[model samples]
Target chain A: MKDRLEIVASGFGGQGVVRLGQTLGEAAVKQGLRVTMLKSHGTEMRGGYVRSQVVLSQKAIDSPMCETPDVFLALSSSAYNRFKDTVPAEGIIVYDPAFVEEIDASLPCRQIAVPAKDIAVRNFKRPIFSNAVALGSLAKLLETMLEKNVVLESFLEVIPKYKDENRNAFEMGYETMNI
Target chain B: MKRFLETGNFAITEGAILGGCRFFCGYPITPATELAEAMSLRLPQVNGVYLQAEDECAAMHLCIGASLGGMKSMTATSGPGFILYADPYGWALGCEAPMVVMNSGRVGPVSGITGAPGQGEFYLTRYPTQGGNFETITLAPNSAQECLKIIVEAFYLSERLRMPITVLGDQLLTDGMEDISVPENDDEMKEMGLRVWPRLYHKGPDFYPASDALDIPPVQMGYDTGALCSDWTPTVEGYDIEEVEEHHKHAYRLIYKVRNNPQLYEDFYEKKYMDDDPDLVVVSYGTPSRVVNTAVERARSEGLKVGALRLINLWPFPDRHFSRKTKYLVVELNWDGQLVREVQRAAPKDAEVKFLGCCGDLPTIPDLMETFTKMLKNQPLERKGWVLEAW
Candidate 1:
C-alpha cells in the first residue's frame, strides 16, 4: 500500500490551527480522498498549545491519530520545538518566520520559513488570517495533488463572511511559496 | 432551504422533531446543553413545547408526564443528570409510558469533565432500572449522523414496546458536526410508519362499536379512569390498594409482559463471518463494535478467519443466539470490563470469555486491533486497566 500523507498543524489556541487542519481535511474529502482529522486543545482556550492532525490517503484510514507526520506546520516557536522531533526523515517542516525565529539547523528534512503573520497583517489587515495564509502555502507545497484554487475555495467555505480578506491572505501565501 | 451548518446537537434536535416528538423537557448540562438549546430554538417554530426544568430530576418527570399525556416527549442530559432521574425513570417503566431519553454522555461518575467524551454508561443503561426485572432498549451511535437516525428510531421502538428507550451517546457523537440529508416529510414518514404509536390502552367509551372505531382516541389514563393520583400501587377504581396479592399480580404482569417481549437485535454483519464453524466470537457494542468490525476485516484479510457479533440492543441480551461452536468470546467495551461480566455469564460453558476494556476518554482503535490480532494468532491477550485523565 502507498504511504498515506499525515499533516500536523500546531499553534497556540485561537490561532486558527484547528480550522486550518479542518479546511485541509475537508478539501481532501471534497476531492474524493479518505481523510481523518483529530484535534486536541489544552485547558486554556487562548494561550495554551493546540494541535490538529490530518491524515489523507486513497484507502480508508484505520486510526485518526498520527504517530509520525509527513509535514509539520508549526505557527508558534513553542509548538515548533515541541513537535519538530516527531516528523519523519523525509518530512517537511514549514514555519512562520514572524513568530518562530529559531529551528534546529541540523535537521534532515526540508525547511521553509515564511512571513505568514506579517503577510496577513499587511495585506488582509487581520493577523488571525495568518493561518489561512499558511494553509495556502501548504497547499502550494502539495501542488502535485491539490490545486491552489481548491485550497482558496475551501478556505472561503469555512470563513463564511470574510471573503475579500481571506482571498487576499490566500493569494499572498500562494505568491510567497516558490514551489 | 437555509443551509445553516449544524452541530451534532442540532442534528439530534431536528431528528427528534422529525420523529414526531412534540414535547421536550431538559436541564442544561455541558456537551448536552447544545441539544437543549437547539430544541428550545426550533420547538417553538414547530409549535412544540420545550421546557428547561429546575433540575434533571424535574426534567425527567416532566417528560414522563408529557409522554403519559400521549405526546411524543423526550429529555436530554449527561451522566450526572442521568443519575438524578433514576427514580423517575423507574416510575416511567412501571407505568409503561413511552418516552425517549437522550444521554449525551461526558466523562464521569461525579462531574469528571464538562466537555470530554466517555462511554462509561454502557453497563448502567444495559441493566434494569432501579431494581426492575427488565431492561430498557439502549442504542449507541458512533457518528453524529447515526445520532440523528437513532433518536428517531428510539422514539418508534419505545412507543412500540411501551417502554422508555435511551439513546446512549457520548460527547464525540453529540458535539461533532456532520453533513446529513434532511429527513422526509410527514406523509413519507407515515408511509414508513415512523409516526405510529402502538396501541397500549383500550380506545373510547365502547370497546367494540358497530362501525370501525379507527378515528376514536385511545382510552388513555385520565379519560378512561375517573380519578388522577400519583400512587405507586396499582389502584382499582381510583382507591389505594388494600389487597397485597392484587398489587403483586399487577406488578408481575407488567414485568412479565416487557420481559417476554424483548426486542430482537439486528446483527450488523452476517452469521457466517462468525467463521466457517469458527472457534471464537467477539461480543461488542456501540463505538467499540466499530473498532471490532475494522479488526475483523483486518483479521479476515490476514486469513485468520475471525468474526464479530455486535449487539444493537444491549439490554435484551440475545441469549438464544449462544452456541457450542463459540469457543472463545471476547467482550470489548470503553468501561473497565463492566459488560464483560455479563457476556461471560451469558456465553456457553465450553466458551472461554475474556475482556479487553478501557476507561479512556476515547478508546484507542490500535489497541483493539492489536488485541484482536493477538487473539486470532493464538497468542495470549494481555489484560490491563486504563484510567483516563480528567480534562
Candidate 2:
C-alpha cells in the first residue's frame, strides 16, 4: 500500500458522491488506516455540485485537501472537466459515461468509462444502485490496497436497505472493472 | 476506547458530556447547527438537557441560567449568531458565570457564506462583549479529535476561571469527518490526557472576591449560599455596586484571574522545527494550521529553514512564542489580517512580520510552498488585484 492515498468523488448533489467517499473511508477505517473525509456542497442541495475528498494514510494525515488525487471518481461532466487535469500520469479517473459523455482525451491520466447508471438500470431497474456499482469498480481498483470483501461489507453497512441488490451491484461493478 | 469516523460536532458533543456539561442551549446556524443537533440527540441519553432558544442572545442567557442553577452548561453558534451573543456574553463575564460557548466560524461579516470556513472572529472572540473590563478564554482546535480534547479543556477552564469560555472553530473543522477515539471510562480519559473539573457551588457570603485566584467555585443561585448575580457591577457579597473601587475590584478579578494564571493555558500551543531557531516561523491557528504544518514539513524537506507555531489557546495571545526575533508569516482564513496584527504587536521591533490571508477555504499547499520559497529568497511578495494581499 502507498504511504498516502487521496481519492476525490464529485458529482451532482443526489448522485451519492459524498456517500461513495464515506463508504471508502469507512472501509479504510475498518482496515485500521488513518482517514479524513471532507464533504462540501454548493448552496442548493439537489442540483448543485457536491464534492467529497477522502485521504487515507498509514501515518498521520497533514493536509486533507486533495490537490492531486490518486483516484478521481467523476459522476458528472462538469466534475470530470474541472478535475481532469489534477490527476497525475500514474493516477486513474473512473467516470460514469451516462453523465460524462464528452471526455478529455488529451489528459495523461488513465480514464476508464464505467457505465454504472446503465448497468444499474438494466439489472436493478433503479438508478440509485449506481453508486454501489461505482463503489464496486473502485473496490477492484483499490483491491491491492483494500480488501474487496471489506469494501463490499462497508458498502452494505452504509446502505443497508437493499443488501442483496447492493451486493450484486457491487460484484457487477467489480467485474466490469476487472482489474 | 471507542473509535469511530465522525464529524467534529459529534466529538464535541461527547467531550461536553464527559466534561460534565449537562445543559446545552443554542440557536441553530449552519456549521454549528449540527453540534446543537448532536447535543439534542445525546444529552437526553445522558440525563442532560438540550434547548433550542429563540435567538443566540437568549441561548447564551439560557446557558448562564443553567450554570447559575448548578449545572455545567454550553451554547454554540456561527459568526452571525455569535454577534447576537454580545449582550449575554457581557452578563456571563461580569457575573462570572461558568459556561462554554462555541463559535464555529463561517465566512462572514454577516452570513457571508454559511457553509464555508473563515477566521473573521479572531478579534471578536477576545472582545465578545460590549465592555472591555473582563477577559475571555478562547481555544481553537484544528481537527475533529483536537476539538474533543479542547472542549473538555474549555469546560475545565471555565469552571476554574468562573467565566464563559469560548471554543472557537471553523466550518471545516466542525463539519469535516475524521477517525476519532473517545474514552469509554474515566481511566481511559485520564490515559488520553483529558482532565475534568467538577462544578462546585461557592459557599459564600463573599462570592465576588477581589483577589486574582483560581478554583474559586462559581455562585449557584438555587443553593442557600445567598448568591446574588446581576448585570450591574458586583460587590464583594454579590450586590449591585457603582463605586469606582468596587468596579475596579470586580474588573481586576475578571481580567487578572485569567491573565495571572497563564501557566494553566500557556503551554496550549504546538511548535515544530523551532529548536534550532529557523529563519522563518509560520504562525497560524484552526484548520489552516493543518495545511501550514504540511507545507512547513515539505519546505523543511526541500532544505528551507522554516518552523511552525500553532496556537491552540487563542486569547491572552501567546506573546512569549513571538519573542524570537525571526521572520514571521501569519496565515489566516480571512481577507483581513486579524492574527497577523497580533503577531506584529507581539514580535520584537526589529523582527519582520507578514500575512497571507484567504477565506471560505483552506490555502492550497502549492500556494503556500511558493510563498515560502519567495519569503526565503527575500523576493517581494505580490498580490493579484484583491484576491489575497501580503504585508
Candidate 3:
C-alpha cells in the first residue's frame, strides 16, 4: 500500500458522488487511518458539476485537495474529461461506460470500464444502486490499502435502507472489475 | 475517544453542546446552514433550545437575549448574513453578552458565491460592527477536528471575557469532512484541551463595572440582582449614562478586558520549521493554511528555507509571531489581500512581505512551491494582469 492514497469521484449532482466518498472515508476511519474528504457542487440540485476528493493516509493528511489521484472514479463524461489527466501513469481510472461514452486512449494510466449503471438497472431495477457497484469496484482496486469486508460494512452502514440488494450489487461490481 | 468521518459543522455542533451552549439562535445560510441544522437537532436532544430567527440580525439578537438570560448562546452565518449581524453584534458587545458567533465565510463583497470558500472577512471579523472601541476574539481552526476544540474554547473565552467571541471558518473548513474524534466523557474532553466556563450571573447592583476585569460574570436577567442590559453607554450601577467619563469607562472595559488578557488565546497558533528562523515564513489562517503547511513541508524536503505560521487565534493579530525580520508571504482565499496587510504592518520594517491571493478555491501546492522558489531566489512573481504590489 502507498503511504498516502488519493481517490477522486466526480459526476453530475444526485449521483451519490459525495455519498461514495463518504462511505470510503468512513471505512478508512474505521480502519484507524486519517482521512479527509472534500465535496464541491454547483448551485443547481441536479445536472450540475459535483466532485468529491478523498485522501487517506496512515499519518496526518495535510492537503485535502487531490492533485494527483491514485484512483479516479469518473462517473460522467465531463468528469472523465476533466480529471483524466490527473491520474499518474501508475494510477487507475475506473469509469462507467454508460456515462463516459468516449475514453481518452492516449492516457498512460490504465482505464477500465465498469457498467455500473447497467448492472444496477439489470439487477436492482434502479440507478441509485450504481454507487454501490462503483464502491465494490473501488474496494477491489483498493484491496491492498483497505479491507473489502470493512468497506462493505461501512457502505451498508452509510446507506442502511437497502441491505441484500446493495450487497449483491457490490459483489457484482467487485466481480466485474478487471483487477 | 469516538472517531467518525464528519463535517466541521457536525464537530462544531457537538463542541458547542460540550461547551455548555444550551441555547442557539441562527438563520440558515449556505455553508453555515448545516451548523444551525445540526444545532437544531442536537440541542433538543440535550434539553437545550434551538431557534430559527427571521434573519441574521434577529438571530444574533436572539442569541444575545438568551445570553443575557444566563444561557451560553451561539449563532452561525455566512458572509452575507454576517453583514446583517452588525447591529446585534454591536449590541452584544456593548451589553457584554457572553455568546459565540460563527462566520463560515464564502466568496463575497456581498454574496459573491454561496458555496465556495473565501477569506474576505479577515478584517471584517476584527471590526465586525461599526464604531470599534473593543477588541474581538476570533479563532480560525484549520481542520474539522480542531474546529471542535476551537468552538469549545470560544465559548469558554466568551464567558471569561464577558463578550461575544467569533469563530471564523470558510466553506471548505465547515463543510469538508474528516476523521474527527469526539470525546466520550469529561475526562476525554479535558484530555483534548477543551475548556468550559459555566454561565455565571453577576450578583450585583454594579453590573457594569468600570474596571477591566477577567471573569466578571455577565449581567443576567430574571436574577433580580438589579443587573441592567442595554446598548447605551452604561454607568457602573447599570443606568443609561451619556457623560464622556462614563462612556470612557465602559469602552475601556470593553477594549482592555481582551487586550490585557492575551494569555487566554495568545497560544492559539502553530509554527512549523520556525525555530531555526527559515529565510521565508508563510503566514495564513483558516482552510488556506492547510495547503500552506503541506507546501512548506514539501519545500523543506527540497532544501528550501521556508516555514509556516498558522494563526488559530486571529484577533489581537498575534503580532508577536511576526516580530522576526524575514521574507513573509501571506496566502489567503481572497484576491484583495486582507491578511497580507496585517502581516505587512506587524512584520519588521525592513522585512519583505508578499501576497498570493485566490478566491473561490484553494491554492494548489505546485503554485505555492513555485512561488517559494521565486521568493527564495529574489525573483518577482509576475502573474499576468495581477498588480502584485506590496501589501
The interface RMSD values of the models, given in order, are 4.4, 1.0, 0.9
Runs of candidate 2 exceeding 4 Å displacement: B384-390
What TM-score do all the candidates reach, one by one? Answer: 0.80, 0.97, 0.97
Cand 3, B chain, TM: 0.98
Better of 1 and 3 by DockQ: 3
In model 1 chain B, the worst 10-residue window by lDDT is B207-216
Query: Which digits, one per residue and each the tens of the lDDT, describe model 3 over residues B193-256?
Result: 8874456778776788887788788888776676667778978787777788889998999999
Compute the lDDT of residue A158 as modeled in candidate 3: 89
Models ranked on lDDT:
3, 2, 1
> Which one wins on lDDT?
3
lDDT of 2 by residue, B171-244 (tens): 88988889889998888889999985556778776788998989888888865777678888888877787789
Docking class of 2: medium
TM-score of predicted structure 1:
0.80
lDDT of each: 0.69, 0.90, 0.91
**C-alpha positional error of residue A63 in candidate 3 after TM-score superposition, expressed in Å:** 1.3
lDDT of 2 by residue, A1-179 (tens): 88889999999999888888889988998999899998877667787988899999999888889889999999999999888999999999999999998988999989999999999999999999999999999999999888999998888888889999999999999999954
Decide which is better by lDDT, 1 or 2.
Answer: 2
